[model samples]
Target chain A: MKIKTIPKYTVYLLLVLAASIPLFFDIKMPNKPVDSSAATFKSLMTLEKGDTVLLGTDWTGSTRGESKAELIAILRILMRKEVKFAMWSSADAQSPRCAQDVITEVNAMMKKEGSREYKQWEDWVQAGFYPNSDVAINNVGQDVKKMFSPKRGTDSTGKLRSVMESPVLEKIQKIEDFKLVIDVTASKTSDFHVQFISSHKVPMIFAVTGVMVPETDVYYNSGQIAGFLGGLKGVYDVEVMMDKGLNVPDKDGKIEVASTKVTDQIAGFPGKDNTGSGSKYYPTLHFALALMIVLVVIGNVEMAMARKGAKNS
Target chain B: MNLELYYALSKAAGVVVTVGLFSVLYKENKFYRFCEHLFLGLAAGWAAVGVWTESLHTIWYDRMMGTVDEAGKAQSGGHWIYAALLPVGFMSYMVFSKKHNWMARVPLGIVLGVWSGQQIQAYFDTYGPQVRAGMKPIIGTSGFLVPGADSGINPQVIAANVYWSQAISNFLFMFTLVSVLSYFLFSFEVKNKIILKVNIMGRYLLMIGFGAIFGTTVMMRFTLVIDRMYFIWNEFFYKTLFHGK
Candidate 1:
């Protein structure tokens, strides 16, 4: 059959093959982490081990691939560094659960690796979900203690206690008390954070979906945020950076993931399983993107040929 | 239930639903419809529960009624004043009643008023820094490139002077900004040739921006598809069915 006349179902089959075939094989894509990813990594790495940060998880299963991968990569770093965090969501109710599942999975992975499992209320606490993004963010910026006071989390003994009492949040009196604000979101909650919280001189970072990259870049360029990770590429960048620390030379004295955006030499958990969904899904994404491009090119070329033939006839 | 059993069942259900939903690619069928309805129902139910548990119960009900320990001892005393918000919240539901439909507007108006007030500050908070950043020096005072820029970032050198590279970048940014603004000149007729050309250029630049966004959107959508494929193949088939972790 002519390429132009190929059935739509056949194209779907081709797409499935393109997406699936690469997954079974070990394919590595040479990557250079973008400036934003570099900057984000630097900011996260520079924080003291016990420093607490606010994690705004506003993504659900809709953008699971990119958002979840981003979360896992960032969480791996935070957990490995022994950084404390209070997690919450204002974008969606489902977001908190999605995040919790990832945290559980990561904690299990940590256990399997013989690393310390991040216990709830000590290493982290769930601040629960707030329905209103704008109002909740404003309240968080205004008084973090008051905003989280009503919320409770199960401690080591399974006793429900105020989130404020958790070691993760014990010292966090205000938004500025946290070292950084990291938002892994599929929605516009990051924008709300900028509106309400950025003015408090708290450094912010975002791991946003692909569609948000261009807009998030505006915030990065304006210095409104410290950095951002955008889409699947962003996840891959973080994973690669996690595997090969920025500006840190390998055995051969070559920087694997080199960036001019950072000055300090931050080390990574090189030998560990820093590779997550990003490393797994990225090659498959490339294959899928290639299929799309090829199909589009063929469709256009066929159209041009048909037009030329008609004109000659 | 055992955790392993729970994960297995969930993965199996997920795979089944995923296949059911995806069957639409072949043709419309009852399976797809069933999955769609199931998804919507689950979402609605989850949202209803989530609204109460994640939001109202903790933020409003608990605060209003206060709390107690396991022994029935009061921890925090009930604040009767908090009950006043319930009326205002219930007023929003009056929209369903024909007799008191206008009452709904009260809460909406208050929300709008508060939102508008926030927007005034938000407008500046969001764009003020951006506006300042947009004001870049087109003149270069340093070398062709900022020193140590290629090797490693030196914040000190960057803070000191605008390099030639930065100057070019800033100039392009300014040009793009002006051209894009010119494209939005719908209030008046553009008779000048330069302005008209700039407007056309702006249109092209906007298209480029839109194209970049569209490309990323496509990539994100593809990533979603890939994730689902991974779930079906690795998570459900390999791990769940075959018991291969």
Candidate 2:
């Protein structure tokens, strides 16, 4: 059977038009912060100054569209709160560079705002990449200090030291000591972290791509994780919550966006807003999705008609 | 127009490459192929540089040769222990040679040994807590069915605590978990009628789970396209190129 082709030039024009139309018109879509995103935002907001969070950066450039935005948003919140963090990668060898690039961008943003610039050896640290994820995670759970001893890197002053010696990691003895474990990933490393680290009673959250949302919901329900931000919608939810703080009792004294879990009751502080990928991407996603749905319907109708004509013949 | 201009040009090249690869959606052609091969070449080049900068130079060479003091660059002595890793790591390259392939086993065996030792404790650490948490109380009097704020009540009153709503939900969860676990019983035939029915139901439930996964995947792809649109319009045109921002 020969497949009918749309004229090649026509197809090119259509794609360019579809991609460019959304840009020409300043399309803005309203977003309601979902429960999972609310949980993630509140978790970050609740962290105290000097508190340390473990960031598992398990994404490479291939997922830059989703994962980069997720990382930047989370880092903005963490930096704003003055929470120190240690980053490590177990997913891919290239992940550490991606994480470093994000940190550099965030630091530049901080500098622009005249806020406290996150220092490499002091405020935040890179624990470097580990080849084996399961072994690395298990080792970290058992004894974080011993597991990371072999990995060494140059400090800001060009002095070679083991990652554990950095000021960010000075007091962190075990996995439970960190305030939260945020896994920003495009892979199953989040599952590995949940199984290994969350079992140690450490608070866990996920910034995952869209496809992983359904499977991740199970972890949220089972209390294996504190909360989740799944795909672009998850990103948008965090952005909204950041812009308009959650649990601010309205004029009627009724709490908006109530939580079923223990940590959801904390009252959110208003103002000091910052928007990232979610806010930027979510509105355009609606247009793209609508186009996809229309295309699907058209293709199905055409297929049905073709089958009917064959039957008649 | 020195280093900064060069940097800007490099970024522009990246943008061009991205557009070239994406052009394949119109129709597969030489432009897409060129962009794809360019990406591969750049990635290989980057990887070579990355290994030296991130791994080999810092971890091995720096430790082996030692370092100098900051003031007037006074030399320091080398640590000879780092030399041992050179031979062990080099053994991994034997994988390329057909006859010497068995030599590659030395490094692989060591990695496997370290990985295997951690698995015993890792299995329990990962799954044990989840299994424990899955067990839920089948009854609650704190307004289970109403889906409102929990009405605080004393734990002492056992009879009053048994809310029909809470019991039903918990019963459902427990039932589903058991049914799903039973579905995996390949050791023996499911002779019992009730068990077989439960197993069949479990299969359907799993399919529902897969459907939800598919939905999420679709949403994610929409998000990626949305982000690209945002970049082209908001960041590139409005903020950077056309608009003064």
Question: Which numbered prediction scores highest in lDDT against the true structure?
Answer: 1
Alpha-carbon runs more than 4 Å astray in model 2: A1-32, A111-114, A146-166, A252-256, A262-269, B2-4, B56-82, B137-172
Best by DockQ: 1
lDDT per residue (tens digit) for residues A130-160 in model 2: 6567766777888998766545656778976
Tell me how candidate 2 scores on lDDT: 0.74
Report iRMS values in order.
Answer: 1.6, 3.7
Worst 10 residues of 2 chain B by lDDT: B146-155
**What range of 10 consecutive residues in model 1 chain A has the weakest lDDT sum?**
A1-10
Candidate 1 global lDDT: 0.90
* Candidates' C-alpha lDDT: 0.90, 0.74
What are the candidates' individual DockQ scores? 0.71, 0.38
Share of the reference A-B contacts seen in candidate 1: 0.73
Model 2 lDDT, residue A2, Cα: 25
Q: For candidate 2, what's the TM-score of chain A, rounded to 2 decimals?
A: 0.89
